[model samples]
Target: MTLRSTGRWFWASDAEGDRGGPSGRRGGALAMMVVFAAVMGCAGAFAAYRALTGDVDAYLASHRQITAQVLSLGDRTSAAARRAGTSAEVAWVDGSGIGHTGMTRLRGDQVEKARVRIWVDADARPAAPPMGGSGVVLGSLITGLVAGAAGWSVALLARSGRRAWTARRAMAGWDREWRAHADADS
Candidate 1:
């Protein structure tokens, strides 16, 4: 058997057979296309990450962190609450000196009148904190890597499928040729 390089793959053939055929060439082209697709996918992921980072930065800038006093703990003894955390009624004043009361989650160890740092919007309403720098970078990198791996897996599956189809066709042709030879000899 002889093996010939087709881009990143090796196409094998018998000693009497020529180096692959149309199917081999098509497979080589497909491989190149898959590589290109993976590259494009990674680039697109990075672009999406940059846009998301900007939006998160804007959110962080618009929000503020303030210390709030826990007035009371609600459902602190519940099994679900204990597993998740205790829900507490907290009060804080925004930059405008307007007082606000809201519900927030705190560790079970927290007690009434305990001071905790919380994020709030301009209206002193409870808000979620934006993604930190390290988290954003790590998340983006993982997403990009997953996308690239998925593309590569699909390419491999397609190549294997094509190879199986080609083999079936070749076998059919060989059977037909053998039958014709047998008939001619009779």
Candidate 2:
């Protein structure tokens, strides 16, 4: 058997069998594009959801005031500050002609204050529970996956193109070699 047939190199003649064949390459490209599109779509949707359901001014006001208070205390680094409870007195009017005094703890610092703000409701219950580290972890994972996939897809396309080009060049060299041999015999 000829080297081409024995080694299954005949497939080289059929462009469809090439790694960068139109259908296969298009499928790979389309899959990569879909993944990119999905990531972008999710990011946009998340932004819109936050805009619609979240109160940006309220969040900013809460953070600014609480952060200032924490910074002013200068007890940010002390572990004791975390355990110690500093109180603020608040006054409110009741049903009768009586006023009331309520004490709220300073908590730790800005980081703690932000955590409380997200987790606790007006009633002081854990209403909007914080996602905590999970959100960060998930975001990192998604970002890494998308970036890796994009890089890999681009590399695959480049490699496939190079392979197809190399195979065509080799076939041309083989044709030239056969022609030279036939001329020598004549």
Candidate 3:
């Protein structure tokens, strides 16, 4: 079989003459701009969505409870009865009026202890705010706009490149054929 039949001659001829042909530099630049714009639009949309749907108050309340628990755990120490012995256990009622237990073990002067309790204010509101829906709407808008811009840019670049390539190829082919005819005539 001939090499051409096997697709081995695909790069044998430089269809685009010297100087890298049309360069396609503008097309590449346009494509990059479109991609950058799309990414920015997506990011803006995501931020808007979070702003609209995220519940700031509920988040703060949960964080406050967690902080109080951490503080209580740090301040409350083992009772005197437990401190005297090699192993000690203590029980205390937390702010929530729930009884909780903690145990400490002293091994060669090193003390280790663990405590468990639940902390959640009875009057606290819901953990999350109601969804606003606006954020998602805004995000969708931004995404659509950006995507459209990017697609438009890419399409324009491709169209221009195709036209340029067609013109260049036509000229080159005509020149080659004319040269062959002239040589034959001679």
Candidate 4:
């Protein structure tokens, strides 16, 4: 096994004079990469936060909760409430005196005819449960993190694209110079 390996991922700079990065200059590229990563990360976090807040607010505002009963025996292994919880059918009455039936995810053991609180929409249909305080916080945090990662990816792509463009331009410049001095050299 020919050992020809260099730590490139952790250290991707200062390999000039023959085998180096694009553009023949890493100073500006490094600065731009840092700036792009930071800016995009911040922007993504902010944007995700704003969107999460708006969606959460709207969902909570449009939904309400009331007492409901388990109508059918939901499968225990249905994966609906497999995490220390059980799934079952439910029944509820909306504000307009209309009755509705739907499946609900209930915590703990919930047999048939068990009563539980469930979220309902305007048409008395089973809706997504209200986002709890902790859920909101956690969701926002995750969203921000994902967005930050996406932003960083975009920044890296942009930097790589710019570097490639610069390298191509440098190559073209060399080609042009060679063609211009062909006759003179001969």
Candidate 5:
């Protein structure tokens, strides 16, 4: 078998040209599959990045950081709580001077009546901080990788099935030809 590269694609042929035979078709299908996977992966990454960025922007626009006074503290029975902080009840005023109270986690050293900065949404309810750039980038990369892998795996499986079916058919044909030849000789 001889392999040739045509700038962007590589294909194989025997002593004679592939001439649209199974090998040539397989080479073409492989190239197409790679292109399809790349397109899908890039599209998935871009979509994820855009969606995450929009969400961050919305959060920044609708949320604000304000100073709150710790009203009380809750118990932390475990040394390894998912939240390694002191649970405290805090009260703050929104942009419109409307007062609200809620429970939130603070540093372990927090004490009652201590002022702390916390994030609050439009409804003056405590909320988590907006996603950072690194988190968004990581999420996008993971999504792209998953998309590409899934597309490539599915295509490879289909190609393998087609190859198996073609080989079976070819073997059956060869058996039929051999039987016909023996009958003629009889």
Candidate 6:
């Protein structure tokens, strides 16, 4: 949907070389890539916004620190490499004096009755730590950069392919012309 009046073409809808020529195909592909990059960047912006605003972190933090009693130990074999803790079933009393139970990580070799600090959400459900502001910023930055780079790469590849195709077509036309004139000089 780019304006071609100014002679600046991003993507060409016609790559078949029969209509708008190879330039059209390359431009059309590039335009699509730009659209994709924009969409990805917008999505990343929304994610960053969500991470920046609201009480997502504060609410979780206010209710996060707690001591829980280990009810049962979990196996560590399935955990990732260098995972410091093993999963365990735990129960703890919230600030409201209400009892809640969940599965959480505990130091390896921790036996039953051992207590550990755990983080819980507003619904008293075990949850991961909230993303901090810096983390959000970093994530959004990386997302935008990656998206832009992807778009550029796509455009570059399409442009090269289009140029090569055009060159081959030009050479073929020249070969046919030369053949037609070859007998004239004989």
TM-scores of the candidates are 0.61, 0.32, 0.34, 0.62, 0.69, 0.47
**Top of the candidates by TM-score:** 5
User: lDDT per residue, candidate 5, 44-155, as tens digits?
Assistant: 8999999999999998999988999999988766675336777789998776788899988886577899999989887788887779999999999999988888878888
Score each candidate by Cα lDDT.
0.73, 0.47, 0.47, 0.67, 0.77, 0.67
* Residue pairs with clashing backbones, model 4: 71-89
Candidate 1's residue-wise lDDT over 6-114, tens digit each?
Answer: 3222242222245455465655656675786688568857976997799887888888888999999887667899887887899987767888999877874988999
Going through the candidates in the order shown, the clash numbers are: 0, 0, 0, 1, 0, 6
Which residue runs of candidate 4 sit more than 4 Å off their true CA positions? 1-28, 75-85, 96-100, 132-182
In model 3, pairs of residues that clash are none
- Winner on TM-score between 4 and 5 is 5
Q: Which pairs clash (backbone N, Cα, C closer than 3 Å) in model 2? A: none
Worst 10 residues of 3 by lDDT: 1-10
Q: For model 2, how does the per-residue alpha-carbon lDDT over 7-118 read when each residue is reduced to its tens digit?
A: 2233333455445443456466557666665665566545544543355445433332211112123344556656764433333433354543344455543432232222
The total number of steric clashes, by the backbone 3 Å criterion, in model 4 comes to: 1
Candidate 5 clashes: the total is 0
Candidate 5 residue spans exceeding 4 A from truth: 1-36, 81-84, 182-186
Ranking by TM-score: 5, 4, 1, 6, 3, 2
Please give the range of 10 consecutive residues that has the lowest summed lDDT in model 5. 1-10
Among residues 3 or more apart in sequence or in different chains, the pairs in candidate 5 whose N, CA or C atoms overlap within 3 Å are: none
Between prediction 1 and prediction 4, which has the larger lDDT? 1
